[model samples]
Target: MVSVPTHLVSADTEWSPLRSVIVGHAADSCFPTAPPHMIKATMPEEHFASFRPKNRFPASLLDRADAEVRQFVQILRDHGVLVYRPKAIDWFAEGGYTAAMPRDGLITVGNTVIEACFAWECRHREIELGFSEILADLEKDPVVRVVRAPKVERPDALYEGIRGFGQKDAVNGEVNGTHTVHSHEWAINNARPAFDAADFLRFGKTIVGQLSNVTNQKGVDYLRSAVPEGYSVELLDVTDEHAMHIDATILPLRQRLLIYNPERVSKRALQKLDLFKDWELHAYPYQPAPRENPPRYMTSGWLLMNVFSLDEKKVVVEAGDVEFAEYIRKLGMEPIPCPFQHVNSIGGSFHCTTVDLVRQGT
Candidate 1:
């Protein structure tokens, strides 16, 4: 009964000629009362007060982000790309939901589409918003693999300290032998099978990912095994102290070019990674420092690195981030500027809000 596409359903790399994509909806996207570990990880210390359960995202900000996302969709449609939007849901009334940031929940590998296991209870239902759209894609592309992420273990409190260092974490119940705990407490713990779609970046034959508060070692392992034969997954040594998604920290412009935020890449890992030495690693230009009390959003300013690619030579950037665009030009790519500050205030930009569903060729 499902309609399936005869050819592959997805593009292989970030800069490939994009043909189809899923654009997230800002409308009805609800902010979570109980944020996941990764959400807490990336937040600035001062903004902690805003994430409290009772807080609601300013309606004005949501409207701006929604307008910006619509503009982005128009730009893609103008370029002849097939764009799909997620069905809207009442995230606030139906419990915690994140309407935007689709890149955090869904991803496509080759022709296969995978619905990732979100790391927090707050976002567990996010995939529901896009279920109809993904099902349609599956009907059209039967060969595409659809892997549902494994169920995760949710504890009352995820402890982050050594077993003996602090009184056994009474919150999560059982005290496991680990150095960290993943929770609202922001502690480190044994890596488990918890991952967010944003933690991955795809290349033709390989994928590069990072372990952060949102993604655990086991989750990375699961991903490594899920891909089709001939494809590989590599874990990057990026600092995950306030671990979250990697799109803002490292971006591959093309096979040979990479853009990174120096603050996020670990100094130790930077020295040991020989692959980086061979590629043209352009340290992204400076961004204005965060205000003394930056408006506490769910994410950090590194969202500036969240750029989207039309192809190896064309990419979408924020209209206000002139420095990022200039750097894109320096890399020999054309930067298409769009207004995204409002949507960004909600947590992500073009790359975060959009997921590529099809690229032109292998």
Candidate 2:
């Protein structure tokens, strides 16, 4: 039996004994709408045409995704973890993205839940529409603090001043004004604080993050100021030009062992942070094959690295990734397989679908 956690929002590290979490619903999920440059920068090239307004995901995919999520919830509950569900919202009606990827909007660090300042306008209301109630409930504990995203008066300012803010060919390889260049120039300008919560990961008192198509320098600064005292946000120099979220780039299986995608981030980048000095970091050696059936609309095949840890010894992985399961097993982790390809069809896998609320030993 699992013991109840004293606080509702208390998690710092990714690999801990998860006591409570929020598993998202997949109903009414739609293809998230964004400006041409933004969409071109982050989404799959073949699926760009489907990202217009009011484009709902195929009904068949949503149904299967919901089933997978429900089964995932059951598996978590069977392990004695408390699960929270968000109120379903019609993404097509709200002109927003699906709530199935809550890790993109909310990050629980220490005892605080900080909402992301979303760069895409379609995702601005995601937390308010689907997760307000859960935040309210979490706030019932005196120790839990919910740091809401500040309203953006001029959302378009984020993309303004760029050479091609709305053009299809704007983000094609040239460095735009003032935008930091990594593998490629970032899509969004540093006009306002903008970040998806998935861009940052908590490691005890230090949060490691990156600037991507959706995350800017200002966003990193805002996160640094919003985190609790003694907590600091550090940026890693990742090499993925198509980067949006950082979950697939790195995976921390437990306290000392971490698995990373060598294709996106280099070993030197990981070494830049003192936090990993004593930790073991291994680059994923195998390249994951692309799924043709479900069709990854938003992410790459590297989503295989997006596994979630239930504790230091056990992790939740996609059922079909037997090769990955076996690989991690050799590293001393038991992979609990669950079917999530349909969930992958929309966006993200286990780590992207849920937010760890109460992990013991934080």
Candidate 3:
């Protein structure tokens, strides 16, 4: 079972478990397929090198995203929440853009964080503590069931078939002129060798429609072992042949209320999410935009929308993402904005930064 912390505990206070998410940026070393050589070869070295590793915000930074990430996270923590952050080279590499300081970890619940699955998940990258310790008392409360993922082998096949194009070698940087593809480290690749192909048979049979593109065989494997028995995870085959990121499509915002960009997510995943009638779904009408290759929409994954502070009728989003202010207004949520904008290029928005630990009780 998970743990919950509350310094000023109240009997009536209930917990939704999936609370607010902190907004911050970290290097995704193995996952995003960022090998310096491969990245440089594919795009203009100048464009890729524009942002050096630093903790500064917008004007000083290449994209003015770091400030957006850090401040947003800090605000969430201030609101009594738990935040989980990645600590490592990839999360802060040249391509990465997180404030090296420790205060920028994450906000999971209101203020309490369960540190049980910390280091193993590489969330802190081994780096610990960054936010104001003055809030430690409130931050220590934990009310969550931590589900740790078990290790698996042959996780590569997922990225292999999902990420790279036809006939491209994933193990090494293979190229055709300017385009290059890199292998992923997150994929599970272990098996009896002989039964390796058969290992996925059970999951294969469950495939009712298109499978999610961002989800690899490894992600599915995670559900097989860790997901709670009553709560199951179904990989929706939601892929918009035109979009780049998948997680952005089937977003899990605040548990019940979610904004799904069906265009970006596969139709199957959309159906799966719809199956849960208990929750209300807000479908986004995102008309396909011309593919902007040069600056790929600054990788707005989820961090931008992670931590949403609700003040009765309004919800606050990280100011770094300009849309935060506007988006809240659209949701009938008063947009409480901030001034952070130092970490957008890393491929995350306000929502992408932190993994939600807990929410207010439903």
Best by lDDT: 2
C-alpha displacement of 184 in model 1, angstroms? Answer: 17
Residues 223-339, model 1: lDDT tens digits: 777777887778887655676788988888877788888877853564465555667776766874463222536666677778898888888898877877887797788999998
The digit string of per-residue lDDT tens for model 2 on 243-315 reads 8899999998988799999999998899989999998999999989878898999888899999989999999
> What are the per-residue Cα lDDT tens digits for candidate 3 across 62-133?
334444555665666666555554333444344333333222232222222322112112222322333223
Pitting candidate 1 against candidate 3, the one with the higher TM-score is 1
**What is the Å distance of residue 109 in model 2 from its true position?**
0.9
lDDT of 1: 0.70
What candidate 1 gets wrong by more than 4 Å, as runs, is: 1-8, 35-40, 153-188, 266-277, 289-296
Better of 1 and 2 by TM-score: 2
Rank order (by lDDT, best first): 2, 1, 3
Candidate 2 wrongly placed segments (more than 4 Å): 166-184
Give Cα-based local distance difference scores for all models. 0.70, 0.89, 0.36
